[model samples]
Target chain A: MATILVHVMPKPEILDPQGKAVGAALPRLGFDGISQVRQGKRFELTVDGEVTDEVLANVRKAAETLLSNPVIEDVVQVKVVREGGCGCGGHGHGAGKAEKDLLA
Target chain B: MATILVHVMPKPEILDPQGKAVGAALPRLGFDGISQVRQGKRFELTVDGEVTDEVLANVRKAAETLLSNPVIEDVVQVKVVREGGCGCGGHGHGAGKAEKDLLA
Candidate 1:
């Protein structure tokens, strides 16, 4: 299996209230020097096969279409972190149940 | 200014409903081969100065305590993306108003 990471962030023009709240709370909680905090979404996708160029292209299309709202968010990254892992190693299938349901 | 990226994800044992929904929706939407999807948070922290060891330590503390819920979420990554920018170039301060309010 291959693991792909997709990072989605708010558009620079958009207001991120959640991030703003966290930024405000940081100083009150004694974490200083951080001037700005913008919160976004990260997705880890486990692919069933090798992370070939075709797979990357498909993943990027998915990232832009389903993973982010282009009006307010941007898909900043879609990179492969792991490629061609055996099914029985430390990268165990966490979505076995879901896969069964989908394939059934 | 410096930019630090913090990635927080659901614990492997935890249930990620958001991710499951996305995974289920993918094949229906014509994106295939993805077996699992895990959703998480990505925070871009724009710091006012250089990202020194002390700053990294502080950010790590903040990430664990405020950025992620240690019970269900894990701070998987805390890395510096950009270090010591002049602040007047393409990397303009997007959080200017927030920074001013916080500094005020």
Candidate 2:
């Protein structure tokens, strides 16, 4: 099983109150070096088996139609975080590689 | 500048209404292979400049205290998404290697 991380963030032109709330609170907490903070939603899709192109397309469609408002936000990234288990000795699948391959 | 991705998710024992809603909707949209869908919070902390241990500590603290309720949710993962520009070549600093260093 592999988990796909669909990261949806507010579009640049739109105002993000939630993100701004965090950014506003940062300096008050005596934190430095943090210029801005953007809050977003992450959807974890755990595949029952291997991930395929069709599955990816459906997931993308879900993200676009249900998970987020396309006009107000965008799918910033989509990556496979875990593939079955940790690839201890090349036995586990390459989750990162899978995402790169999908992108390419 | 470096951006830290703080991912917080509900503990296994707790009920995730938001996640359940999505999980239930997947099949309705013809999305197969998605056994479960868990929704979580992703905070992008964009540092003003370089990331330091002090900055990491502060960010972690913020995540623990304000971003999530430690009792019901946990900080599952924290990683550096980007550090400066994409490391296309040797001249560009590594964004991923830095995450490994931090983990180690």
Candidate 3:
């Protein structure tokens, strides 16, 4: 199976009351250094079968068209992780120590 | 500065209508192997000054008590990245090629 992760955020111009509140609260809780807090959404999905470029592209389109609001947010990063085993069989590269695809 | 990322999800017992809808949309998008789709939130915050254990802990507490819903989601992975020169001067270990602290 493949794990597809999606992150969503509000459009930059839009006021994020949730993010603002959290950002403001951090400083009061002894985290005096935090300057900003922008909240976004994450999704962990397990898809059937092997991962393919076409399927992934479709997932991206689905996310853009239906899942997230691109107007307020700038990026929607999607990473596909091949599951099962810890690479003992070398069933494709596992996520291993890495969590996100920054290059994306 | 440090980047504090927070992920949030609905309590498992509660019905996640948003996640459910996205999960349903995936199969229709030609992703036949997908069994479940759960959505969560992500926050990227740039903190002031250096990264410290106490500040990080406070950020976690703030997230739990005010930012995220701990019931449906089991984990909130936080990673501190010191940004500036890409480790040219080696000012503390940067996030570098990896993202997200899965160990947390």
Scored by TM-score, the top model is: 2
CA lDDT, every model vs. true structure: 0.72, 0.68, 0.60
Residue A65 of model 1: what lDDT?
A: 88
- Give all TM-scores, in the order shown: 0.79, 0.80, 0.74
Candidate 3 lDDT over B1-104, as tens digits, reads 65666656565566778778878876776655567777777777777786677777777776676676565453445555456212111212234343435223
In model 3, pairs of residues that clash are A11-A72, A11-A73, A33-B48, A40-B42, A42-B40, A47-B33, A48-B33, A48-B34, B11-B72, B12-B72
Query: What's the best-to-worst order under TM-score?
Result: 2, 1, 3
- With candidate 2 superimposed using the best TM-score fit, by how many Å does residue A49's alpha carbon deviate from the native? 1.8
lDDT (Cα, tens digit) per residue for candidate 2, span A1-104:
77777777787678989999989988888776778888888777777776778878877788788888988887766665446431111111222434431221
lDDT of 2 by residue, B38-68 (tens): 7888777788776777888888888788888
**Highest DockQ scorer:** 2
Winner on DockQ (1 vs 2)? 2
The segments of candidate 3 whose C-alpha lies over 4 angstroms from its true place after superposition are A28-31, A84-104, B10-15, B27-33, B84-103
The alpha-carbon deviation from the true structure for residue A100 of candidate 2, after best TM-score superposition, in angstroms, is 5.1
User: Measured with DockQ on alpha carbons, how good is candidate 3?
Assistant: 0.42
Residue-level lDDT tens digits of model 1 in A1-96: 767777788888999999999999999999999999999998888898666667777788888889999788877665555544311122232212
Residue A64 local lDDT, model 2: 81
